[model samples]
Target: MRPLASLFKGWFLIRRDLSSSRRLFLTAVSFVLPLALWCLVSYVDWIWHPDIKLQLSSEREGNSTVFTAGDHISPGYYQEMVVATRAENTRLLASTPPPKSSKRANQKLLRQLAPVAISHDWLPYTEAQNDASIYHLWRDIATGTKIPTDPALTPENLDIVKQNWAQLAPLAADFSLASLPETPLLKLIPQGLPANPVYLPAPHEVWRSGWRDFKAVPPEGELSMTQRYQHSLRVILLGFFWACVVGVPIGILCGVFDFFSKLFEPFVDFFRYMPAPTFSTLLVAVLLAGDAPKIALVFIGTVFQMILVVSKTTRLLDPSLLEAAQTLGASPKQMLTRVVIPGILPNLYNDLRILLGWAWTWLVIAELIGVKSGLTEFIETQGRFRNFDRVFPVIILIGVTGFVTDQILSWLHGIIFPWTGRGNPIAQTFFRILFWPFRQISKLSDRAGTPT
Candidate 1:
């Protein structure tokens, strides 16, 4: 009778310690308000800002020629610099006074190639110069027109040639240098140069075509707001799915045994300190050799933070829970299935919620890694070109997406594991308005269920 009485009291105490309702509600609402505000702001902006248009809409259908040569300008400028240098070398070789041996010939050839004075209008020249200097080949690639090589091109010269070859290889179909009819410099040039594609803001130009509301228009194609929303959601879902696939089993192992924890502890700690973008680079070098840098960035950043949350939460599970299960004649598998997992499930869900929030931060870093798509990519691309208006909307989109994701995770946690939440006093103040309605419902339910 005494032992039975003690068991009941112990169960009651544990239940008391574990029982949490208001705390969970408060925690949930605390995370939800910011997301709501963000969504509201985004929707309002979409309603009011009707001037902006997605880049893809400006193109005439089937007019692929409109794709600017400026897209290839970075490498093109480098090639021009190399060509200019080679020309200088040819000029030096043809001069009346010739130099001695092949090696001396090369050295003399190089000496004869002096730096050309560039005009202020030569932006391409400047860009190439900057690129070559950083790569330690400005003198070789940019000044090489002054020399001739009987023995062969120097390694420095070879490197420049290699870089130029690599750059041209992908666009071999598009390379051309055609003669044009002479005319006035300004008027002789085609107004819409395919290569330059400089912006010409004519007052009569259509502000937006087809779509009156810029926000509703897809950035490209037959894109709509619904499509953009779907794409964004898919990215988040894919990211979260992979995170769980990588994080859960390891988390279970860490919780179930002490040895596994020790083995992975240092690795987890080291990775936690490392920035999420590092994982993107490391993964790119290993698994997906062909992965676009942007994809690698997303995968690395998502998994890195997810792994930390899962392992840390598992590491913190109560040791006593396992001991008690063992005392009850539970088999190891049974202990894990019934006691260990349920004990850690709440913390796991909470970690997942926090991890989703971290995913947004990683999203920007991922998009910056050579991706030409997504809100983060758009924001970065615009920001680099100093298009503040375009950049701002993309930033707002990212924030709204992050906020919505956070809210969803919170709502899921509330519905799935109501018993898991314990209160932090800090959440109470922030969630007062959010909590009041729920509190009233709880009171009404209690009164309805009570007997007269």
Candidate 2:
């Protein structure tokens, strides 16, 4: 009970201190405004482009049917085929007797499940490739062979497979018996299809797509969001730890000693101006691949900036406190320990918290350099595959993670430096509000322990 009370008291104090800042409301609004904009852009489809349309026609000549379907934009053909296949599947499913044992049913299904037509256009390229991959997987399953690993399949499609595995298994078995060639089919449906097809998905569709990927297992050879997030956290923390070790001491030295400050200030300032990413080639060459280069990239990014900030903070320390300590017969080391360190510790903590947010910015670029196994990599891969759903969520994840981390560090700063924002009336009010519930709890506990 005492420990719980202590914890509550700590939480209460932190909350009270943070509430002192009227900027918090503005900060919250800043976050909400972007989300509102995102919602607006997504719901309105203000930038949506019209999908390419493909026309397919069949003509009978000399008792032979000639089927033709092609479009100037190749994805148009692939998109039409996908829609047609889905429609054909629905029609077959809706038919009587289920077409379970019919030879014609098997042939038609196989024909509909033919290899996707390749398109030179970039728009349909990935979709066509994905459909082709799915077809191959379906063919393999139908033939009673193991499904080949496909890293390109989005999590949503993967989830669909997992959910309908039982139904698909039998379908695959039925499909295997059909002696169909692996040729591309020219079956096309009507144009001006509803705007809600898989290709031209609305903003909600994009969100749903991303949500599925967020909840689903990543395809073969790709890291899940959880895995990527953990990797990113590890990389950022490792780099931050090393940066502190190197930067903080140097920063302290620069702050306290004029000679040290003169020697290091120019170099730190100059290097910080140069972007950390430009050094990627050198870092990669020297450190080689794997975690070393990535970690080095993060370290390079934060360390120089941290050094300058820490030095500035240390330089800002009150000279009167240092003079008082010296006049009290304290040695140089003693003056630093008693006055300089203590004087700047709170401000330093706040500086480090702000710098930590900057560290996450470097993290995405760092992860891109070597291993390709973090949230940034996931976003890049999904973006290449045009899985904007997966990409958008990971991007949002980065922002949310950084925001939450910053808030948590803010709370910690308040706890560590109780004097921070002490005189504000808003803080006083917040303190009272936070204490009320705990006070009531303590009173109830005391009453229960006494008479009952």
Please report, as a residue range, the 10-residue window in candidate 2 with the lowest summed lDDT. Answer: 114-123
Q: Candidate 1 regions off by >4 Å?
A: 1-229, 279-295, 421-452
- Candidate 1: which pairs clash? 69-195, 85-144, 85-145, 86-145, 87-145, 88-145, 88-146, 89-145, 89-146, 89-147
Candidates in order have lDDT scores of 0.48, 0.63
**For residue 247, what is the lDDT in candidate 2?**
95
Q: Best lDDT goes to which candidate?
A: 2
Model 1 scores worst on lDDT over the 10 consecutive residues at: 184-193
- Best candidate (score: TM-score): 2
- State in Å the error of residue 450, model 1: 36
List ranges where model 2 is wrong by over 4 Å. 1-32, 45-173, 181-207, 218-222, 422-452
Clashes in model 2: which pairs? 142-172
Please give the clash total of every predicted structure, in order: 10, 1
> By how many angstroms RMSD does model 2 differ from the true structure?
13.9
lDDT tens digits, residue span 174-216, model 2 = 3343533332222223222222223333346456555655655
